[model samples]
Target: MFEPEKQLVGEWVLDVRPEEVRVLVSGFQSWSEAELRPLTDLQAVPMMKWRHEQGHDPAFLPSGEAGVWRSHTLLALVRPDGSGWVGCAVDAAHTFTHWEARVDGQQVRVTCTSEGPAVEVAWQDTADVIGTLETLSAQLGRNMNAITPTPLRVWCSWYSYYRDVTLENMLDNARLARQHSLPFDVFQLDDGFQADLGDWFEPSSHFGGHASELPAQLDALGFTPGIWLAPFLASPTSKLFRDHSDWMLRGEDGQPLPVGNNWGGPYYTLDTTHPEVLNWLRELSATVRGWGYTYLKLDFLYGAALPGVRHDPSIGRAQAYRNAMQALRDGAPDAFILACGAPLAGSIGLVDAMRTGPDVAPYWDEESRRVWLGDATGPSARNALHTALSRWYQHSWYQPDPDVAIVRRELSLLNHHERGSIAGMLDIIGGLRASSDPISMLDEEGLALLHRCLQISTPDRPTTLAQSFGGAVTHFSRGTFNLTNQSVTNLPAHAYLEQRL
Candidate 1:
């Protein structure tokens, strides 16, 4: 059995619940200026707070060298064999503004800012990390007992167009979605459609300022038009930032803080506590809904919830996030909320589909080949799929979206083996499936694979992870259907199914 311990330092108390999980608690700071020398979780390094505030899951190794790093909210502890439990400071804000998790060899620690009743934690010892999160899911008001998720086959505009998506290209894909024989529920537009980051109502010249009508046009063609929005973010050049800098979350120096660097951006976070900002979000989201867009992919969302000096200091980042997400829910009550770049603990009851991994890039490995902890929150298909596995327990909270499952062969630089791997991984793991490929362009073989991947997990039978070698090779057998990122060419069909899920 794993042992649990607690330490009291400077009015801060680090306690491992039930005394069964062997954990160490301490304050944490992210290594911000990390150079070509990539640091995993174990190494003692100075970490910056801004890097992982929002974006893919921030994977950490662990450490306990105090003075080098300050305390931050959130920590995990496990036995040497990885059979312990993990927890986050769910609503523990009144006591401490900072919390962190650290791992030193087999020891783990969780430290808070000052230690108060505001911290409520989730704990479980299932040996499966997924099970630990599953326990946390319930405490966050997302009881798996109440949710019924549908497997989705989505067609997104990002992987194919990047930020260069135009009205013409999106319309063609919508048109193809209708005529294509494949089964698809949502025809979604990604980043390129927005006029700016937080400014949603205004569309660029490419959209002809007519994005409000695009959703209806797609719906008319037999698809649920899905729209993407970074509800909490605004680019520095955008109208939202220019007109309402005062309404954004700011630093101690009285300047709006940049949450994370993405899309060649120093994106700004909106202060959800400000009534004006919330009102604006409510109106814009409703307008999108009025235009017939039912699926909302909220990206770059960590900004709104990043631990920062906000307009309302009384409200914690969790509540700030809840406030903003509540507005989206209130604004578009009927829409499907696909939350990406979000804090996993606080997002429990809000979103219908949670992006469990990083942005699945077209290629497998780039600068950081080993799925660095920093890159875990950055963009990488390999990391995306890999993180998806580590977060499988989240499927019980919301339909886990493993990002885009790319199947196209011609335009993509990914080899045939790599293409099948992404598609297969998502098919087996993700509750929501989306292909960021132009359906009209995909050849027959690609189209066939897309069709085959659509069989979803039923309410009575959810997919399970049978075996994995850190995502390099994964095998999952859901009922009679056998699946693996390793191509069928590599593993025999019988052996694939014979393995349990």
Candidate 2:
């Protein structure tokens, strides 16, 4: 039991509720950066790569020295023998649970705050790290009863064509997919489809008034037509923004709250609490589904949950986000809702699949930290694998999408070993298998490699660290892989290793 009289640093106060005494744990190990590394202990390394993405789940970020660390919804501090405290807010549906940990040698102080609804943290003490996490995963899923959609091999157009994707590009890829006998169930048109972010009904000039026609064409060719859009976002130039300014979430200045910089400038969020905005979301989703596109890859969905003035102030951020997701579900009842860049706790049972990590780039590691300040939540294969492995237990909540595996040789910067490592990681931590390579550009070797990736059928299980050697090369079961560029060959089960790409 915690002795507040001796351990309390200062006065602990609650903003939403009156002060109440709750003593949870006692005798935590000396807190250091090494003590906090996600799955291993690297005492020599002072800094750790903590992930802070808008829609991604919060993973462990162990600090060697004293610093400020934060996690959303859940947090756990486990030792080599698996003795520690695991705390999670059961009321995440009503409010956002933010955890901040401050480490000082032997004593690690933690503070949890929520925007609304009184926080009720559920704490557990465990000697088995893996079992505790699995139990926690089931506990979170009790109310969700999430539906895992049928495993799908998908072909996407984003990585190859990006915003320059023309309808011709999609058709050509579809042809190659059929000719190569690729087992792709969904042919997803990512981004680039809408004339603007919020205006999903209008197609860009690249479609040539054939956006609706393309979906039917793909359907006739035995593909589930899919499309990507940021439904909660409205670009400044979008017709939706110009027509209904009142529908946008605003800041304290009474101006539209800018969510993030994208599409050449900043974009704003739609106030999901607004009755008309919810109606529009329902209508938008219905319209997209009506076009023979049953698979909806909703991207950049963090917009709806951003801090701003919502039309309804009684509910918190998580509730607001769930409300919007509910509207989309109501509209596209039968469509496959793949939630990308979405809040982990808020989207439970609402989406068929969830992107478990950040976007995967053609490269192995990210070079620059100037823009994102060393956050590992950016688009890199190494980044994706790190977070995905850390949160591998989430498969019970929904189908975990580890993002697309880029195996094709051409139009990519990844070398032989780098590409192979990506494929290996994706195969071991399986969920949705997707490729964005323009197949026609690939040679026989690349095509064969892509074929192998699509055929991998690994059972989803909790990835536990077997051992840790200064965070160098991490190993996994079914196959051994690495987090650092260092290579790791065949290793025994439950043997932890690390290697950088």
Candidate 3:
């Protein structure tokens, strides 16, 4: 409920309608606008703004247009007469162009009944005015909290290549984990299980002809068996691709889309919108479940949300992902879902856990640069700290995976201080991942660091707080903090005390 004349300066309310959502940015009058400016700007707004600004370029060209910059925010009102008002605004230029929204007293809500993409309603409330804009686009998803009674746990994915891991190796590792008494509930088998990624069902020769037994072995060891599967992607040589070439995403020229270089040569993105594809995925999930696997890590999920495709854009990217997630849930109702490379907001209320950072490494260097850098002048742990801080609320509401905690390993090319810094940050944030293969060539000190990290628990909020370059780290009363080093080279780190502020 809202009072027409009441000033909404410190708090705001958001309500969604069937066609559009009304975001009332109250809490400010003319005199208080100055104070609110810092919170609303992208560079200064902290967590919320940091998440919103992802994938956006300062200079962007909108779809179906060129040369001119796309409107930072576009608003339009369509009436039954087929003629209505259109508005646009550029926050960078401090200009509001073609702005028009029906204002009811001090409240304004924009309605879009058009044939374009789903509509987005954005507003910045100031002391004097409530800046509002609505764009015809997709509706985003919200991050949902994890199931109750499940205490936050940390575990790691097994990159076999990194440590020559095998089923026997995993069993040995599990034995070590049990002996070390590390707090980890799941152990993920990453990237080396299938004969090849393209052939999802075929087990690699190294699996000893009994890949299915790995889960039970883990179960006997008191750990859950988690396997990595990219549901939307298929290798170019995959049998599914051979059987249904048309099932993959197509370019404007109707050619099969390239899967990109990160995974392999070229693969296809499954059209999740197609009923057959959904059915296939459901069956695949059922098969995986039949093998006793209880957890599934869905990676490279962003590719499934591309616009202007066969999907129903009216439902928005978030909803499309929700649908896919629902399909996965229907197939494996009891399995835990770990979503990665997807928008955090869009995954709200859907996934059981999410990867908040790219990948993290044991040290800072060129090989590790993709996930995190080691340079003090760069973002390093500093950026990761901000990310962890901003997403702290998720721990109370949902499971937050600050990526993997790479414990010190002999094979790992990181130094002692670097390992200490990484360990300290993981301890503070209380993330849910750890990787220390038994056969991997790690020393006692490295294993000790990992054992210490696994003992840390997730916090409701971070303790030591610092913010820069759209990132942050919040330390907790438990002497742990969540750190995010977003820059390619710079890493940030913060210390935490075991007492509440």
Alpha-carbon RMSD to native, per candidate: 7.2, 7.8, 12.4
lDDT of 1: 0.58
Query: Quick one: ranking by lDDT, best first?
Result: 2, 1, 3
lDDT by residue for model 1 over 1-501, one digit each (tens)?
111123232222234332233232222211111110111223233143445444321333123243212323333444434455455445422333344544333333444443333344444445654345455544444432324357667788888888888777878887776676667888888887777787777777676546776776777778888888888788999998999999988776788877777768678888888888899888878988888888998876766655557777766655777788888889999888888766554566677887766677767655452334323345555556555644444566678787777777767666655666566666556588788788777888887877766656432222223233332223344422222334354453212232344
1-501 in candidate 2: lDDT tens per residue? Answer: 101011111212222111111111110000111112432221122122222213222222323232434556666665545455566656446566655555434355666655555656665666665567567766776656677766788999999988888888888899889999999999999888778888888888776555687897798778999989789999999999999999998887888877666578778889999999999999989988888889999987777776667788765667888899999999999999888878776677888888877678887766464123534456777666656655656677777787887877766777776677667656666678889998888898898888887875654443344343213123455545455444335432222233332
Model 2's TM-score against the true structure: 0.83
Candidate 1 RMSD to the correct structure: 7.2
- Misplaced by over 4 Å in model 1 are 1-50, 54-117, 122-148, 369-374, 458-468, 471-501
lDDT of 3: 0.46
- As for lDDT, the candidate ahead, 1 or 2, is 2
Model 3 ranges with Cα > 4 A deviation: 1-149, 152-164, 311-316, 365-386, 437-442, 460-471, 474-501
Count residue pairs with overlapping backbones in model 3: 61
What TM-scores do the predictions have?
Answer: 0.77, 0.83, 0.65
Instruction: Report, for every candidate in turn, its global Cα lDDT versus the true structure.
Output: 0.58, 0.65, 0.46
Instruction: Give the per-residue Cα lDDT of candidate 3 at 309.
Output: 48
Q: Where's the lowest-lDDT run of ten residues in candidate 3?
A: 27-36
